[model samples]
Target: MAGKRKTKASKAKQDDLAKPSKWRLQHGAFSGPIRAADPETGTPVQHRRAVDTLGMMLASGSITAQMHEAGEIFRGLFRAACFDSMSTSQLLRIPGSRVDTLSTMQIEARRRVAAALDLLGGHESPCGSCAWFVVGLEFSVREWSMRQGWAGRTVHGPVGQGILVGTLGTLAMHFGLTPRAKAA
Candidate 1:
């Protein structure tokens, strides 16, 4: 007898939960209370079915237009990504700033590559944070190389390379220097 009562109570609760709330439909449709009776003639104004509203929208071409707009946006994004990749590739090539002999140039290149990696992978570069240090080193190296004429030993393009190397080394050294106040 007790088991039967428990089963009946559970069944009643399940049925209540399964029933859709009338308040949801009423409040969702309009601000005021909904009525089947027409205000002017007291005749019934038949409420259109939910499926009919969807069918009408589809028939009117609005849904298709929305879909077309969505497709266009996706296509535009895809093309834009392709263009960005191609430009980035060109910027990283043989004569680009990254390949320059200046240490600052290398640092700048690293920064750009890190940014591109982040854009592609949604992560920051570890080396990016230390780029300033690299700049200082490059500057110092270039200065030392120039003072020493290190390029003279090289077989080809020694003069130009020594200038490049020395300049970068000097810049790197300048970056690392801590300024001391001038004596009066």
Candidate 2:
């Protein structure tokens, strides 16, 4: 009878182990609460699903796909920033409007990327040369992706390059490939 009771207790323990834990069922893998606002802007986050999806793609190693998707995201942001009444014809008629718009976006992207790299804790060059280096690295990646048959295009090629530079640079910094900037 004692041996039988021990077997029964072991079986009960096995059953408990087979059942998924409550936390696992609730959060699956990620456990932290999602942020409601952008850390920089303090505004309610927009395109939450798209941003999360991009993160998932990056984790999954779908680089080229994410690159194309990033272009689409930039285009969406550009459109969102435009006046609601602005039409495609009106936008096209402005002299250098497209170039100006794309340049603005690229500059903004580069700035944001640089800020992100700083947040990742690394020694970056004070002359802002590291950001440009990141831009070149990102541009090379874009060109390579194009060669590999990525079809999407941004209005200004540098827009995607700037974003890529910031991202890859941050990764490099995180891995200690890029040294942290020294205090003056």
Candidate 3:
């Protein structure tokens, strides 16, 4: 009976091993091999130099953002690259952008709404270019808010107003979304 059981177990193991492997091979997941001659140049492509150049390109904002989703994606990836799980807000906070004592949900919802709008219309360009545009506007608004000396209750109100006004100005210039300026 023991021998019979041993035989049955061996048969089961054999059947398991004989069954077709469950793993399917995935494709195109690696960097390709180096060719002898460079097409662009009439010289052989130096693999090490090419790799170093590639790393620099990834470090750059425009190419990186173009390859990735956008500044937001880059920010997340940057946070993750640190090998820590801390939230992004905890990583970097622009001055005057922080609310002293707000709920996490409220803060996150605001950020999400802004991120959604930013991602809309396929605006996934690099921060290197767009930084000047977005941060310039943000800076102007912050200055305006400071000048206005917005009170406790109206702090959000002034910032909202500034953003709305700035966005309208941008749209007016770019898309003629609002009435075009008349020639003098």
Count of residue pairs whose backbone atoms collide, per candidate: 17, 5, 0
TM-scores of the candidates are: 0.16, 0.20, 0.19
User: For residues 102-149, what per-residue lDDT tens digits would candidate 1 score against the true structure?
Assistant: 355445545544443343232222222112211222223223333332
Q: lDDT per residue, candidate 3, 1-184, as tens digits?
A: 3554444445433334422233511311223344577777779653322222213334553233232223333334323333223344446667777635546554564454344336333233222213223332222333434433323332344454444333334323332333445210
Look at candidate 1 and tell me the lDDT of residue 15. Answer: 34
For candidate 2, what is the lDDT? 0.41
Q: CA lDDT, every prediction?
A: 0.33, 0.41, 0.36
lDDT of 2 by residue, 1-184 (tens): 4564444445433334434456656633442444478889899753323133234445667444434343334334334434222344454476554633545665565555445445544323311332233232222344433432223532234444444545544444443444556210
Best by TM-score: 2
What ranges in model 3 sit over 4 Å off? 1-8, 11-102, 118-184
In the predicted model 3, the residue pairs found to clash are: none
CA shift of 34, model 3, Å: 25
